[model samples]
Target: MTKTYEESSQTGDFLEALRLAVERARTEHSPTDGMIDWRVAAIRGQRGGIAGLNLITVVIEVKQV
Candidate 1:
């Protein structure tokens, strides 16, 4: 079965937030079954309010190779 991973990050820099979100997804991934196929399912960004920070979300899908 395929597995889905979701990660989010908030930072003042847009690139930083995206990098953090992707890093989180990679850190949480388990490769127990062997080499796996992975893809980015979605990327979302939103304003975090008065602070002007950005909230970034990344979704990943994975399955055994």
Candidate 2:
């Protein structure tokens, strides 16, 4: 599973943050069955501005076979 977020900053810091989090989770064996089959989790940003940002958080629950 994966979660994503976006911000209006000129630098790609948020992307990097999400990538690092996923990588850490994968390495730490937090994902079900030790593998990532799809994006089962997500936190998306719907709005952004110079002062702040608004986001819609999505949570995906997975079941292992």
Candidate 3:
């Protein structure tokens, strides 16, 4: 299913919030002796309603720090 603008925006916001939370937690609780990276590994989907699928998509990206 195609994502609506609201949905996409919400997802992006959620990811950003999560990244910030993680960074804060790491700074407070974990030692910062090494580099850190946050990334979206993948989003995989196949297109179909009730029968054979016609499309497949997978998105993957590294989050920039």
Candidate 4:
């Protein structure tokens, strides 16, 4: 089986946002039913536009073990 996960973050630092997004991708894991492989499905980013912080989104697909 496979599953898809999406996580987004808006922060002043681009790397921090990306790191957070990836860190949030997997909330939990188990030895018997854990992810064996991960593939990046998409990445989207938008400018803060002056009033808001920059937005970064990351999508990933995981293959079950």
Candidate 5:
């Protein structure tokens, strides 16, 4: 199975939310040496069930370099 960094944003727009997510991820997870790069294998937003009407899930992943 492919493994990726997953995060959630509270924005209706995917692109806008992604920008913020990436920045946060980089700062939090990026190495101090700066030898690693995160490649987005997939970024998706899914709708939740009836309970979470406006719940948005953001899934981010690093693909094979």
Candidate 6:
């Protein structure tokens, strides 16, 4: 199986973390969604999924404040 690729952050800025993740997805030419596991990640907990792509299936998660 192909390994999942993700970008996660814990900078304490929720929007910034989401922004960076979305930017990473587009730059990497991939949709983020389940590509990340934030809790065990560089950040922790689920703030919810922020949609970046046309399909609702694609999402970017942010760290909770």
> Candidate 6, TM-score vs. the true structure?
0.35
lDDT of 1 by residue, 1-65 (tens): 66676667665354554555455545666556534566777878788568786777777777634
Total backbone clashes of candidate 4, pairs 3 or more residues apart or in separate chains: 0
Model 1 vs truth, CA RMSD: 3.5
Residue 32 C-alpha lDDT in model 4: 57
Off by over 4 Å in 2: 1-12, 30-34, 37-65
lDDT of 4 by residue, 1-65 (tens): 76766767675454565555455545543445433467777788887667775777777766666
- The Cα error of candidate 2 at residue 5, in Å, is 14
The global Cα lDDT (0 to 1) of model 5 is 0.55
Query: What TM-score do all the candidates reach, one by one?
Result: 0.57, 0.32, 0.30, 0.60, 0.45, 0.35
Candidate 3's residue-wise lDDT over 1-65, tens digit each?
11111112223344554455455434543444544443344443445558655433333232333
Q: How many residue pairs clash in each candidate at the backbone level? A: 0, 0, 0, 0, 0, 0
How do the residues 1-65 of candidate 5 rate in per-residue lDDT, one tens digit apiece? 33355555665566665666566666666656643355555555556666554434455554333
Residue 2 alpha-carbon offset, candidate 1, angstroms: 1.2
lDDT of 1: 0.63
Of 3 and 5, the candidate ahead on TM-score is 5
lDDT of 2 at 41: 57
The superposed Cα distance between candidate 3 and the true structure at residue 19, in angstroms, equals 0.2
**Poorest lDDT segment (10 consecutive residues) of candidate 4:** 27-36
Best by lDDT: 1
| 26-52 per-residue lDDT for model 2 (tens digits) | 554455558743343555545568855
State which candidate has the highest TM-score: 4
What lDDT does each candidate get?
0.63, 0.45, 0.38, 0.63, 0.55, 0.42
| 15 Cα displacement, candidate 2 (Å) | 0.6
lDDT of 6 by residue, 1-65 (tens): 12322444443455555566566644554445534333312344344448332211123443422
Clash pairs, model 6 backbone: none
